[model samples]
Target: MAGYLTTHVLDTARGCPAAGLKIMLYKLSGNSHRKLLEVVTNDDGRTNAPILPAESFETGSYELVFCAGDYLRATGQAGDDPLFLDEIPIRFGMSDAEAHYHVPLLLSPFSYGTYRGS
Candidate 1:
């Protein structure tokens, strides 16, 4: 079995998908981080392809940075300074290289949450 990674973003405030949101994937190593990929959410609040394809999947610690504040501001929901939730970073580990990892974010201007999904 081959492993892969995926993600999804939802705008809970507007009750719709978070389109055009920017996402960055980074591989972490000993207090150092290397960016792997950058992607934007589609109309369905998902990337057009997997965040980490099976060919590049590896067992390690990874971080996902989501530009939620910019997204909300772009959608006319947030203003400058003192923004509630800005960039959200999710750090997780891949223990099983053969299992699928789905990180889904349910977000609003003031709050957000994420979990491992199927």
Candidate 2:
């Protein structure tokens, strides 16, 4: 069996879908080639679809890079100090082939969070 990776971005500061944020996914190095997963997000702060397709899934670490700078810049949220962490990475293992992974992020101008979700 194979699994898929899903994610959603909620801007706690803005209280809306981080509509224009850019993001990237990388499969950690392992037996697999470990290449950059296709980067995509939607108007609702979620990916148009899952990051990993169900058929090509496997066990390994993955990193999600959220373009916080881009999001703030576009939204006029970036401050003069740039205290907000721009590149937020969530690294996790897809250890269970039968289970789906959902990585959800709630971010603000100064902070953010991420974890292995349903």
Candidate 3:
């Protein structure tokens, strides 16, 4: 079964799992982003666990920053001038405290996509 805020990083450029990628989950505050959680992608390109636990659900705006540039660089799949996305920030709103919110990201060097999931 999948958990809330589950994400997978697929290096579309190489069609491989983006392991060791650091990701930070943040909630939008008044003027700055409040960090909710931080984790690195595992071998399967997934987090070790859901960023949001069962007892930690809350209503707020969230952002997920994917360190794609570093991930690609470490994997030796980056060019000197590779346009790695420094930060891929996805802004979303959570209104249901009891409902689960899953955010998945499919990323490439040149582009990326995000969507709400179960």
Give all TM-scores, in the order shown.
0.97, 0.88, 0.86
Highest lDDT model number? 1
Point out where model 3 deviates above 4 Å: 1-3, 82-84
Query: Over the stretch 13-87, how does candidate 3's per-residue lDDT look in tens digits?
Result: 778788899999998977889898899999988898878776676677888888888887787766677455767
Error of 1 at 15 (Å): 0.6
Q: How many clashes would you count in candidate 2?
A: 0
Clashing pairs in model 2, backbone N/Cα/C closer than 3 A: none
What does candidate 1's lDDT look like per residue over 21-77, in tens digits? 999999999999999999999999999999999999999999999999899999999
Residue-wise C-alpha lDDT for candidate 2, range 72-104, written one tens digit per residue: 877888888655578887777888888899999
At residue 47, candidate 1 shows an lDDT of 97
Scanning candidate 3 in windows of ten residues, the lowest lDDT window is: 1-10
| The 10-residue segment with the lowest total lDDT in model 2 | 31-40
Candidate 1 local Cα displacement, residue 77, angstroms? 1.1
- lDDT of each model, Cα atoms only? 0.95, 0.80, 0.79
Off by more than 4 A, model 1: none
